[model samples]
Target: MWNQPYLETCCRSALHRLTLVGRPGRPDGLKDGPCLRRLEGMGLARQREDGRFEATPAGWDRHALEIVPRKSA
Candidate 1:
């Protein structure tokens, strides 16, 4: 499981086109890439060959609750 802080830091906007992590203006920041890489290493996501980082299947599993609809009573 990804650390709460790290997971919370992940960009959640569906329309967000920025693949690079960290602050919005600075794409070449020191901590951003590494932090994103660490998440990739942990199987939370994958850095695509196209330079975009996408959440892996396991990553989806980790966030399943967010995707799954609640059962109607």
Candidate 2:
């Protein structure tokens, strides 16, 4: 199961584009930490040779599913 930290982690989700891990001057900018490393290990995200991080296809799908609220009766 996904933990709060994982769900709350900052992400930029778009239909046609993947996530960029860090942002300029953002307090929540991606840090080189365990969470990020875990994401990469799961193949949900990747760190480029240039040290930039981006979301993989699986990551994109996960993010999309996360954003949509499930209907309740």
Candidate 3:
């Protein structure tokens, strides 16, 4: 349970959203409220001093591994 923390549907989506850069109207980043908060609590995302949200390194890795579709090898 420690290696990979569980993520809800909303949080997973938020995590994926965090990987996106320069989103229009998203000065800080994805603001999915509770989802973002949960991700932050789980160490997946962090809020910048400017009050914007961004994915942490762990969040990026998690998104890559769990969200990004893998090509069949």
Candidate with the greatest TM-score versus the true structure:
3
lDDT of 1: 0.48
Tell me, what's the RMSD of every candidate? 7.3, 7.0, 3.3
* Candidate achieving higher lDDT, 1 or 2: 2
Identify the runs in model 2 with alpha carbons over 4 angstroms from their true place.
1-32, 68-73
Q: Would you list the rank order by lDDT, best first?
A: 3, 2, 1
Evaluate all candidate structures by whole-model CA lDDT and list the values in order: 0.48, 0.51, 0.75
The residue-by-residue lDDT of candidate 2 on 1-73, one tens digit each, is 7753354344323211334433321121345344555666767677676665566777766765676545779
Estimate TM-scores for all models.
0.45, 0.51, 0.76
Q: How would you order the candidates by TM-score, starting with the best? A: 3, 2, 1
Per lDDT, the best of the predicted structures is: 3
1 or 3: which has the higher TM-score? Answer: 3
List, residue by residue over 1-73, the lDDT tens digit for candidate 3: 4668778888888777778752321244335778888888998888777777778888888887889967889
Better of 2 and 3 by TM-score: 3
Question: Candidate 1, residues 1-73: lDDT per residue as tens digits?
Answer: 7544344444333212222332232232334566556656767567666566666666555555443435779
Q: In angstroms, how far off is 72's CA in candidate 3? A: 6.2
